[model samples]
Target: MLAPAQSAADSRSSVEQLVSRMSLEEKVGQLFVMRVYGHSATAPDKADVDANLREIGVRNAAELIRRYHVGGIIYFAWAHNTGNPQRITGLSRGIQRAGLAQPTPVPLLISTDQEHGAVARVGRPATLMPGAMALGAGGSRTDACEAARIAGEELAAMGINQNYAPVADVNVNPANPVIGVRSFGADPCAVAGLVVAQVKGYQSAGIAATVKHFPGHGDTESDSHHALPTIRHTREQWDELDAPPFRAAVAAGVDSIMTAHIVVPSLDPSEDPATLSRPIVTGVLREQLGYEGVVVTDALDMAGVRQKYGDDRVPVLALKAGCDQLLNPPNLDLAWSAVLTAVRSGELTEQRLDQSVMRILRLKAKLGLLRDPLAARREVLGTVGAEAHLLTADRIAGRTTTLLLNEGGLLPISRRSHPRVLVTGADPASPSGTTGPPTAALARAFAELGFKATALPTGIAPTAANVEEAVTAAAGMDVVVVATYNIAADGPQRILVSRMAATGVPVITVAIRNPYDIAQLSGFGIAASLAAYGWTDVELRAAVRVMAGRTEPVGRLPVPVPHAEDPARMLYPIGFGAMYRRSGV
Candidate 1:
């Protein structure tokens, strides 16, 4: 004997009530989001996109409205060049116009990974911020939040809504192949505190904020994009390490969550991926934690989801598990058809579909998607690369400067008269090309600062031969600046370590990538080792500024540098670097 259904007023407050107004076909349509990268400047392929028109049955932006109502569109690799933006804007207008073509207007949730710095979208005169670790090391929640807000404003200017940002994972594993600089810091509290600030920053400016890699992908030695990772933490460990930041982000009212592919036996069976796991997404995140927002899956195209499973089973499994949106594959046909099949077969219930559609609609409404839709859409896209945004990038970029070691009190490189300083590390020329990896803006900045920069080609493999060549090259330089681009690779870059140690002369190691790259270098005889945490133009200039004594080195090392250990199995053994300011510096 169940109670009667809620009164009309009570029903109006519910997601089901709002979603029930949509047609069954439109309800199904809301489950799919489509996007294309780097192909939207000229004809049908550029903005209206080939897949959106012919492949997915969306002929133009108007179809997005008149026909199947889409949940959203994800944008990646939009060109900053003026030649392309006009057409891109036209495409966005088409997407908005098409979305409005429906009997009842539906706001398309536009999303992108504008984490700012290395994780940026909508090209510019190039305002690059430092990586998250650089911001964390720089130590200002205010600046981090402002950076995110600025990123949101810029994203909005480009008609982007959801910014998949403020990566909440606290990086605990130095061996992490991908989520190194993206994470806030290793300490969960620190990550939570800063991310909450970023979430507010995004929301304050009217953009929906996304908190990501739920259940923590920070410590995994493997990248989920290539292979599924198995987390070995206990339930208690989850409370300590993984949940805090997410909890904070949720509390801050983030509109969406991006689930990771990592599996944990302690939490669920090894057979289930987190994105499609009820125990994780629905049971844990939704029921127990009470997160009412949309749960977004990491790109379904990745090997972790695509390779491990033989079928396209993830789509239905994830929807049933409580996730609301499936991102990237751009394979809307397969995913949409799969969802339809599941619905028809009763594998995916109408109840579940209603719930997902309702959340999507409510979020869209909340973001002002439905009301005067195109104008709101236009408002957001209008914010891209405004004067204020470019300025803030420089501010955060400047603040991230950290001076790790300056011996003989020789920094702010006193305006010495034509003292030829030889900067040697990754040589831009060579078959293999610089051990420092490919970063052109960085090379240009280093050169402009007047160091006769010579890059030595070195692979990520840490070998003795590479070290000898580097040492021999640097023997005659007045000052040697080694750009150590620490990679979070499966293997070691040991040659980099030996070369740094090979020198007794003033060898200042400037880590251009992961600060964790410095862990092995202490064994090499380096005069001073600094963690630049990133290799963007912002980072390069910040490093130069610190060397030139423009800004005080306020950044504390965010990750523990590795000490002597088996290169095969990395061990972050060194005491994380502290504020070591020289008297004159």
Candidate 2:
């Protein structure tokens, strides 16, 4: 899968020798991963660093590298928000330069949550491809592989060597707050197929792919960002539903597996989340599944792990639990000092610390970061978000436009009739607080297709007054398209759409984020239902063409759409899609 680790014996020897020479502080630093900002050319000047200090939480990138010696640096939307390719490249280059400047000069693993689709952290300057669910809807392993390959290429071009992506979680729970659209789908076998392809694709391009939320974050309803979620399923049930994709990932030689914040009682009887549970992380993922690669913890700062374990204690617990990388610790100095102290005392042995440090160094060596950490700025600027990559994204989006329902054949609105289409929708705010377009971009694409389309942006959670206004406004429209962003979770948006459907006009519902929205809104008399899986410009445009009869609705539902009234009942099973036919009648 990955060419037998490529000179495995030599790499191990090098890492062993390097670890032998490192001090306890340096070796401890190799286990912690921290966040740093101000990578872009447009970043505030050094004198103005204090002005933005409260926002970025650090005066400069050098502070973390020089003081803590973090093994990796994670970039969020804030750090690379400027959609400027040159600036993003400069940010990555600068971070690498800082790492290289260390005395021993171990290269930092530059990573981001570039899961493409709705979860992209550095997407503005890179090709914004459809996410895992969208690719699953397309039902083409080839397209999924290509989308990941393109993402890997763009990320690698920008000097980012790791992507916390290809979410291996099988989203079986409709109420899952976090992994809905981020996951590939509901079926374990189907998710495994796509997961393996994505792993090959990313690693083939030289960017390490981290298959996430290991025992599975799919069946749980709670969001780990705020609280700890416990999966009560037995080991047998887990093996049946949750563990297949991860097992597939290991067989594919994935570069990394990100542990979930949720606790699995089946794996570990204790209440510790997988990130801190030695039985789950080391016993199950390593001994049982045989994953020899790196094991990274999901942001330790998240409330799931943070609330249970203090900031000072998480780093040591994570290392003792067999995690190679401690990602996004809340208190860097405290965590570093705790791990150092643990090693100094008998709490954590020196050999245990060396085990993780050696793994981190070996991974760096595998990624060729040890050989050449700096990227050529000229090459990055030229290739990041290149037109070729954008075209690939567009094609994948087109294939992923799923038509879940077409009752009474309401789609393919005729241009001859010059249908007055009223497009109304809400833009769900991202977890990172980023806002997207008010109206689904489909409205603009409708006008481009020669239909008289008007977009009315509604609040995410609309009031009764908002619903009344939208329903009254749709009275005279030939067809009303109600676009929903996570309407399954937002009660007001669902009410707004139901009201529009009650207007006795042809109401076509399009799920702009989660495909499960169609199942939730199926009780309403929707003339048509489509799942774009994401609200990207490419996805929106693709949805418009499918509705306009310009392109065929080829995408199938990746996850089963459960009935709104009864969660166990399926409104539409996975692999469901209606073919569009050209007709004004």
Mark the regions of model 2 whose C-alpha exceeds 4 Å error after superposition: 1-7, 40-48, 51-58, 80-82, 430-440, 488-490, 581-585
How many steric overlaps are in each model, in order?
Answer: 29, 1
Poorest 10 consecutive residues of model 1 by lDDT?
427-436
Please estimate how well model 2 matches the true structure, expressed as its whole-model Cα lDDT.
0.82
Report the lDDT tens digits of candidate 2 across residue range 494-519: 88888898888888888888887776
Taken over the whole model, the C-alpha lDDT of each candidate is 0.67, 0.82
Model 2 TM-score on a 0 to 1 scale:
0.93
Error of 2 at 317 (Å): 1.0
Q: Against the true structure, what is every candidate's RMSD? A: 5.7, 3.2
Q: Which residue ranges in model 1 land beyond 4 Å of their true spot?
A: 1-18, 37-42, 45-68, 78-88, 307-311, 376-383, 415-418, 421-440, 446-476, 487-505, 566-585
